[model samples]
Target chain A: MDSQVTRREVLKKGLIGAAGLTVLPSVIAACSTSSATTAPTAAAATQAPAATPTPNANILTGKLTLGNNHSDASDLKGVNAINDAFKALTTLAVTTNTVDHNTFQDQINNYLGATPDDVFFWFSGYRMRFFADKGLATAIDDTWAKVSSNFTAGFANAVVGNDKKVYGIPVDYYPWCVFYRKTLFADKKYTIPATWDDLITLCKKMQTDGLTPIAFSDKDGWPAMGTFDILNLRMNGYDFHVGLMTGAQKWTDPKVTAVFQKWATLIPFYTHGYAGLTWQQACDTLVRKTAGLFFLGLFMTGEVATVDATASADIDFFPFPFMGNSFDAEQALDAPIDIAMISAKSPNLAADLVNAKAYMEFWAKGSTQLLMYQANNGFIPTASDADTTKFDVLTQKAVQIVSKAQKITQFLDRDTRPDFAGANAMQSFLLNFLNAPTQDLAKLQASIQAFWDALPVYAGN
Target chain B: MSVTVMAGQRTAHNVARRRLSRGALYVFLTVLALIFLWPLLYAAYTSLRPYGEVVANPNGFFSTPATLNLNNYFFVWNGGNYPQFYLNTALITIPAVILTLWISSMVAFTISRFNWGFNMLVLMIFTAGNLLPPQVIIVPLYRLYNLIPVPAPLSDNGLMYDQIIGLILIHTTFQTGFCSFVLSNYMKTLSKELVEAAMIDGAGVFTIYARVIMPLVRPALAALGTLLFVWIYNDFFWSVMLFKSGDKRPITAALNNLQGTFFTDPTVVAAGSLMAAIPTIVLYLILQRYFISGLTLGSAKG
Candidate 1:
């Protein structure tokens, strides 16, 4: 009887304990609400300027939020310095939210869907258009109208959506070409090839010299796309390359197969075990003088600079050699533009618009572009009026190549829907082809076509 | 005398065999120890090397002359927001470990000591909660956290989405299931006579649990506490998804920011990882004895 009573008492206590545990969260919630009520008011006070109308204000004067993806230490420092300069020019206080670069790009959909900042860093081309078409990005035509004279027609077209309104402001661009060390070429008595046959001959010569001709890496799965894009641009015209990227031309078309066949011919000259190496590691090979040539963007200079500061001066690139076909002339090349856009879901749209436009106009100025270019010479300024006097020898040569080109194309990933490009479809497809170049082209084409066909049709305005 | 001599010879032979086997065991353990320590030594060695040297000799560590320096450590420490990350991790981990222990212990005590009709059913529910993968409920939990409005003191951003408190609450709630299962089985192995005797001595239920039950479960609590600390400290997924602001992220999540977009030096990454691993190693060392005892406590039920 005593044991039974003890058991009952224990059961009663357990019920009370469980009830207390259940009530604990609610208590915390209630306590948190009381303490947290002041924060929103504080936030609103900071955002108070947005509530008032500024009908005729020319210069934006308020707080502006910017989401930046320049997560590299050097790049972040440079960007922050630019923001500080912007703040000094206008009375607008800028709050910068810096996220990792890859994370920012991968999670952009969710980031934009939620309450995004007033302005966010992004890439130009179909990437900018896709967001603008979905109404996630605000039309920056009003800002573009002010800065129209500052940029070239090519840059302006890159930011314009299908709806005929600008969505982003292009800041900088870099061309992709065959980069080689000037010293290495000078030592080996190798001349820059001007045609497909000359390029192949040069590769064989380099091989006989006991040097890897091309330093290639596809571990990150996007560097190989550079080689593919250049080959396609050289083999087919820019129009067909763009068509293939946008899914307007079939992947199984003979034109596409021809591009792969051309790539396979040069595979023997590439660095062995490239599939496991990163682009930086590949660039290291070039820096260490083990490789002859590397087809990459001007950003390769960043890696070279780390090894030898003066080696950047010894770096020079020529546009991928002409293929001697129907489209024989080197009229096209890859020149991807980096851009910044205003988010449609910004909390204070009016204030955000004024601040974001001011920022765009600031970047449009040659003086502002000069500041950025001077800080990091990885890419050239987009502004035509930017001071070219301060450009390095490499930058000057890049300008020459870009100016000679009749048409410039964005890279494959930037030209297509991000879902298709990033969902391991194209990356893996290219890797599979690189691993076995002699595989049936028909089967490869079919797999790519099937993958593209299975995608849900994107509905956009 | 001859019989005694024969016995002495047999004893000496046995001693020789025992000594030989002990020597073999030592050799085996030494090899095992080296295998475990090899990666750590490599990481430490690589962290001390310059980025240029690391890149130049990717295939082997000893190919180049070892110029051990603290530059990588200095760069990682002074260059990044590691101090803030450490604070964030500690703030989340300490509370999470304590709450999980307290709540799990209370539940285990209730289930083990009580005679309620639904005791076994309740215990089953707690165990079953841990059976499901965390990924299965991540989306729902993400939405729920976003929807929940936390106070400013508890959350700087006024939402549960990017708050340390939210991480603590989630950790405590999700981990309680596993802790309660382990603690309850451990409690069952204890003698119930003491609890019955305490009740006869005019003690209440709380006194019996607090005085009689908890003191006996100290080893288990220490073991669970150490394990929970490491698990909560190393959590990457929830910290990344829940925190909107980079500043709000814990150490493990913040480690991703150490890598630059285009140029990441592996030496700096190695140094950062070694720094991040120090706390868990210290905790394990401190709790070594109790951890071992607690793990083997229920293994043999003789």
Candidate 2:
């Protein structure tokens, strides 16, 4: 009886404590509300107007968001600096933007729906065609016609859509090459190979020395596309290259077979554990001096150079040498990613388009080009003013190949179905090849055939 | 007297053999545990390595001279927008956990005590809700959230952190269905005599619940909180869609930013990945005792 009475008293106290806990939240809220001002009119009134020389609400003046290293539409300048620039440029305080490489497609999707940037960075080629197809990017042909410079002319055609309408101003004419460790080659008494067979022999020598000859990450679906493009250009030529990608040519063509054969030879010479490794990991092979060469995009300069600045200087590149050319002018595998576009339905549409034009012109300047090169060394310049000499000796050779190349082709994966790039066709090609190498040559042939057969119309063959 | 002593000695030998078998069982369980835990251990181990070290020795995980560089942690904390993300996550998780415990407990109590119109139907609906694919609802929910006239301060640059409420709602609402089912089943098995006795003593329904039910469910609360914390922390998709800006983003989002097209730097990636892992690991460590006890109690027949 005494214990039961004590329990009741304890329960009564617990109930009182619970009631007090409930009202405590309200009391805190009341105190906060009494002290807080809901509006910031007083703060806004005291602030000076941001400095915008000839601030035209009409210009829709905002900083151009360029893709970083391999990121989607973000600024070349890092986020905080980009935000400040955008704020100063627009006189409307812009906060921040972010981008990622693997997840760029989704980021683009998010940007398209909610807040399409005023002047976003983008790539050139069939990659740009999608934005043009969706009517997301505006035509800047008029602006291009007015800017009378060799850079504009060189890049103008690349950004033009299939409709013959220009959608974006091309910033990068990225030319990919076979980049190798110059130190490794020199140490082995190996000169940069001139022919396909010579390259093979060099790879064999490297393998004998227990070194990987090439560093390619097929795990990153797009990087292996470089090998195919380079090989196909050598075997078939530019027309076939365009035909196969545009879905006009058959995958079972003799040209594709030759290209596939080249890849088969190259496979044994590449770094170990290539199956799920990303391109960056592949780059690590070179950075560690375990591998010799890699077929990377012309834009790879930025990527390869960023591998610890001290170590990166040791890295250099060469033109991906071919046994021969597909066309009279040398054809190489290269294209663009990060294709910026403008909205057709934007209320600030025309003004935004003008700013976009101005941004292109502004970004294309030699000073700005120098700025970009300084910021990210591997940035391939479409503009003539860009000092290609800033690159190492081997990179200069690659730039020579790029500048004088007859026809620059697109990376096959990006030029194909954007959704399906890493999903089915290319995925099957790499995985099936890697796992089932001993199965049969017929198995490889059949895999390519199956994708080509089931491909939807408008998928470039 | 000699024969009886010999028989007792044989019995003792048999008891020793049985103890040996139990020890073998433990050894077998430990081996299986190691097999399951090896990948997690490897990931944690890799996390401790610097970027350059891991890159230099991709295949050399065991042998790599990795020093415990907390730099990756510092990078993720300041660079990854963790403070803001944590605030947003807390707003969602705390309220959701409380609401789940409160509402689920009430439902369980009512179900255990009383049968009413549509009680079974409500229970079935929750079960059905849990079974439906979360992905199927994403499009509709995206549309619905967009239509909410209460101007959810869209940064108008990209989607902002305020919209994390959408993710919170989704997680809370979905988890409630699964969590409530488990909790209700446990509540049903609870001794009915205590509640009945309290009612007989003239205690009200809530009073009986307050006195009899909560103390009994402490273990359940701990088990659910730990489980949900692990799931919610590791979640990527909801965080990706719901949060956009680097400042508004979580550690996972920050890690994504490190993947540049120009260069492949897996060092920063490995470091960043390590930082993301530590919190949940710490949570797991702290709650492991409760997890073991609660699970044993819930599964075992008393």
Best model number under lDDT: 1
Against the true structure, whose TM-score is highest? 1
lDDT of 2 by residue, A1-461 (tens): 99878766765665566466446545644544432233111122123432234654523433333323234222345334433444465554432244565555566655455434455555666667776676666776776665437464436667678778777655555567777766777788888877788899888988888888888787756677777777777777777877877667877776676676667877878777787887777776777788888878655545554445566667666667777553534655564533344545332333344555655555555545555544554455566776766755654665677667666776776666564455577766766776555556666766676776675656221
Worst 10 residues of 1 chain A by lDDT: A36-45
lDDT of candidate model 1 versus the reference: 0.81
TM-score of chain B of each: 0.91, 0.76
Give the backbone clash total of model 1: 1
**TM per prediction:** 0.89, 0.79
| lDDT of all predictions | 0.81, 0.62
TM-score of chain A of each: 0.88, 0.76
A243-349: candidate 1 lDDT, tens digit per residue: 88888899999988998998999898899999998899889888878899998988888888876667777888898889888775547888999998899976555
**What is the TM-score, restricted to chain A, for candidate 2?**
0.76
